[model samples]
Target: MGVKAWLSKPLAAYVHKKHQSWIQNPVEAQQSVFESIIKTAQHTAFGRDHHFSEIKTHADFVEAVPVRDYEGLVAYFNRVKEGEQNILWPGKPLYLAKTSGTTSGTKYIPITKDSIPNHINGAKDALLSYIHETGNSSFLDGKMIFLSGSPVLEQVGGIHTGRLSGIANHHVPGYLRTNQLPSYETNCIEDWETKLDQIIEETIDENMTLISGIPPWVQMYFDKLMQQTGKQIKDIFPNFSLFVYGGVNFEPYRKKLFESIGREVDSVETFPASEGFFAYQNEQHDRGLLLLLNSGIFFEFIPTDEYFNEKPTRLTIGEVEVGVNYALVVSSNAGLWGYSIGDTVKFTSVKPYKLIVSGRIKHYISAFGEHVIGEEVEKAMQRTMQKYPMVELVEFTVAPYVSQDKGQSFHEWLVEFSIAPANEEAFAKELNAQLQKLNTYYDDLITGRILADLKIRALPQGTFRHYMKSQGKLGGQNKVPRLSNDRKLAEGLIESADALNTNKN
Candidate 1:
């Protein structure tokens, strides 16, 4: 191992120890950490630019830098197109990670050579921590399969940015790179169908010891494998030891995967974005998701309720408390200072800084004045599933829409199932009832009968794949959107839901 790798273990140890202490004494620890980050941000590439140069201290950093949405990013990209070197940060970045922006279209997030180490190191710590937590070091010995996005990079007016999976593939050591299932260089540019076919062919005979990627793609791969072999996943990859996933919640699909595979697999959650890898599942899985506090990034949190309120307050890692939802913000070496990624997280425990993702700040349904968040939907679904234990939900999504004649808004549920209840209508009613009970706002809407619709569309086995295929977004970094709040996107999703219902009948 190189010097950095050699030093990483000790660094990881130190960070873990310090984080434990910080969690214990949150206020003081938070101040110290925030001050250090502010200092770092002011001196690094992020600080030297015109946009960030004006800020000098932690308070100034928070106040001067306005909270930005996708539109702000689009404006930055316009500068990038104009050959402006530093819109968000100083320095000519090495590459850009292309991601589908929620609203303002596609985004090309700048990634510098200095920033890549943060991602690699954070991922390394995540894997090491998982090993320590589960006491399952055997996973490291096996061939790990990562279902990533296309590796192809497109040069837009001489600026390079490709899908995140492709970038990760290209950055891996050459020796380990050969072990990867689909060659990133070839697969990144290949059509989705061709790529899926290649993935199926590669994994058919290989001993895939560990599988990692977005949940939806993993599901699709497993489904395809089962169809091809007529054998359960357990029969095919008996040695499969781990399932590492991120990008979306895995709870809904967890039971179904276990049922199909016939065994429990060790699972780890990763929080990575185009900007950088932020957090990972730590040694104490119960403590919550571990933030990569030492990843050359300054972290901040805005209380969930304060996000929409004017002049929202920011909290440092040390100041965050358990059960409080906060919008995650980061100032990274890659030049994004005080950037909010739109993810909302709740600290499960304060002592260890363990957190669970609550939901995306933008991804919620409030059509009928009932503000339903991702967590609310997840809890409702979990309760419904508990009530009806026999049926397995393969995939599900929730959207808010209004009935034209009724002039009242309600939630519509679309569920894809492998095994549905004997009485579908009764199942739907029970699910709706569970949801109403869990969320009072939903209950009020239902009681008033203002909630005009509660629809469940059971999809065929491969229905979800159609959306992934149509978008040309599968594997690796791309994830199936769970909760869509945007009206236009919801409409497109409804079309797919309708198609699935049509196919079933």
Candidate 2:
């Protein structure tokens, strides 16, 4: 082990012990965080508007601040954009995590001085937690690559504004900075393809130990590496032991990733967003991520079933039950109050409050009253893929396909396969069967003759990548939705696939 790796072991142990104190008393930790955020921002514009001064309890908070998404919070965000200090948080925000918006063109989420630690520490703790558990600090000796956005920042309301990953790039710890890969100029390349190529060139021969990225992008890097050198990732980076990923489920990509690496390696999953770093996998063997209770954010859970109701039941950490899907609402030091980031999570353990991200609130399909979610589709796909080992998935999406000819509509699965299955019909049938088994409503729709069997649109490889590139969302935290109620994205993907086929013919 190198000097830093040797030094990290003791530090990791200390951090682990400190983490246990908070883990053991999650409710208390949250209560403390809630109080701290509320008290600190009590005089800010949002705090004053929401009567944060008088709020003393979670109930008071629920009454004072209504749950709102980005669109709902745009008014205050507009003030912040226009260089207004104390509009959301006290003084001025340290940075704005600029992300793509749905209805709105662009979203500028504030990253306050108080909230910045949560983002940085959350990532720090994940790696430290891994070190503490496995006693494998040697990986820290090799070069680490975080496949991320450019570190380039632009002025927005006099605040440094960039993608969350880019903003995070500025704060990579000094110790790790020397070990971090893909030189600053390479990272600053705007086009994802160019950046990716540059990254491969920079790190291809380095002693890359830790690789961090979303599953799809990382798979692209792996694929590129194999094509460039005709060598598996394990051969290229013999010491590559840790695969740190987030933004999407790793299960679907697990088979392909391991195949590319030529062996299985330890992986860590994180629950991070532009708003806050909510959770991280604390244990190597554990199933769920440990929700960060003392991360300068207060979390609320609105049961996903009742989330659409006018007055959804919002439960605090003390009240949430295991296995129930709940939309995650957060009030944080960043001056966001009762903000719903649209993520849905299901608690697996209440003892230490570990949860799995279920899906997104808006990223589901209920077009035919079959309320299918991302988790359901992902689970089905995973199971089916397990049975068909040869079928390596590049990417896939599910959307409702309404028949215009008065025929029954169906759920469409647009899949790009790196290695297609031998029997395409059987693969589609098994995939549909798996989905039906997971979602009773979808099963009912098929059995009741209300909908046709889920159709598989076997897209040509690189179709999803091309589609994403066309929309200018090629990389860095941008992921294709797992489920869509409407066919807007599905139609575009279909068109792209058709174009590719036409060009080939």
Candidate 3:
């Protein structure tokens, strides 16, 4: 057996045992996780303050530790930051996963010695499970490249701080480290342009077989590789067989990635966050991730429809129904207590427990009471793309333009297209119609004359890339906001496009 594959046997065994525990009875598995964490952390301040010692059941646990967003946990985290042990988790964390959310700005998420194993071993099992099912372990023999953030982490208080990918990379097994690409020095380059160049130069001639990154940055690398080598990805590395991705909806970029690679390859989708690694696509035919019930992260769901009410129902694994949108609440060994991660999801299956990410709870555009969401917008774009053969989407964001001068308001879409539609007017009309059909409030606003027809501004090619680069968020994991409550992002994108055109002129 290949050395990497040989090293994966133990992980495969772990996944086998864990997957059985999950699917046999998901509710029971999640209960086991909850009890374990509560028992371990009962001595901590958060546990004692919330009376976790007296909590004997899931319902009691929920009542003890109220569901909280990052803001609610900040006070407890501050104590941990000040070199306090057993404040949130069992001990002080060794590293912090620094996250600058699109709206929430910078947040330093904790990563503890107890919690780090969940991230590492679970990640290892995800790959091993994919291999066990696909029987495509030969790819492990060739170079595997993960396009990640800078490995050079900054010290925050007493802990090392960096992006989650960089923190995870630090714990990469010594065996797999040999097959990994891009020297540590290359990965530490702060400037994405410099790092991309160095990675391309270093791995251009390697016998690469596996690739992993978010879709957008991977697309960027593919574009550059094709441009420099004058060859498709398949031609460059005939053995290139796997592409693993996460952190954004992959459907929009699927066609582009296929075009770049020039052939179909096996792919695995994972749901990972600074909080914890939650789920992954366990079956090839089943795209919905098998929820990691046995993982160290305990899961709860508050139906989004009822979330804003005064004390909405929090459903355990036993209560969740397929097809309902729920705001995911998590309590992980990583020291978070009943934390709302802000992302929303819909369960696709309830028996074995699987789900697809719906959208972020805070990322919808409800200007003028239309209440449009990211999923609706994405579906609209997908529907339009089906009708227009000449059009390809790069990235898009929508914002309301309220002009006091005219006393009217409309959504202004800043969209960068790879191939311009043959008829922009018709394209916009159909897209608007599709969205109208999806959300009744949006249609009512248009019909009631409360909002004008959507305005589309076709951005120049590379506008989104340029905008992202300008913000120093050119890497994967950081996505351009799809829908904004305000015009800040829309105006910034428009300004960036204008600058690009001005330079060209």
What TM-score goes with each of the models?
A: 0.67, 0.75, 0.74
Worst 10 residues of 1 by lDDT: 401-410
In model 3, the Cα lDDT at residue 21 comes to: 53
lDDT of 3 by residue, 309-389 (tens): 767789899999999999999998888888998889999998788999887676777545455767778888899889887
Which order, best to worst by TM-score? 2, 3, 1
Give one digit per residue, the lDDT tens place, for model 2 in 75-150: 9999998899998889999999987554454678999999999999999999999999999998899999998878
Could you tell me the lDDT of residue 327 within candidate 3?
97
As for candidate 3, its clashing pairs are: none
**The best candidate in terms of lDDT:** 2
**CA shift at 248, candidate 3, in angstroms?**
0.3
Clashes of each: 4, 0, 0
Q: Candidate 2, residue 174: CA error in Å? A: 0.7
Colliding pairs, model 1:
147-476, 148-476, 151-166, 151-188
TM-score of model 3 (CA atoms): 0.74
Better of 1 and 2 by lDDT: 2
Report the lDDT of model 2 for residue 176.
92
List the candidates ranked by lDDT, beginning with the highest: 2, 3, 1
Given candidate 3, what's the lDDT at residue 402?
57
Q: CA RMSD for every model?
A: 14.5, 14.0, 14.2
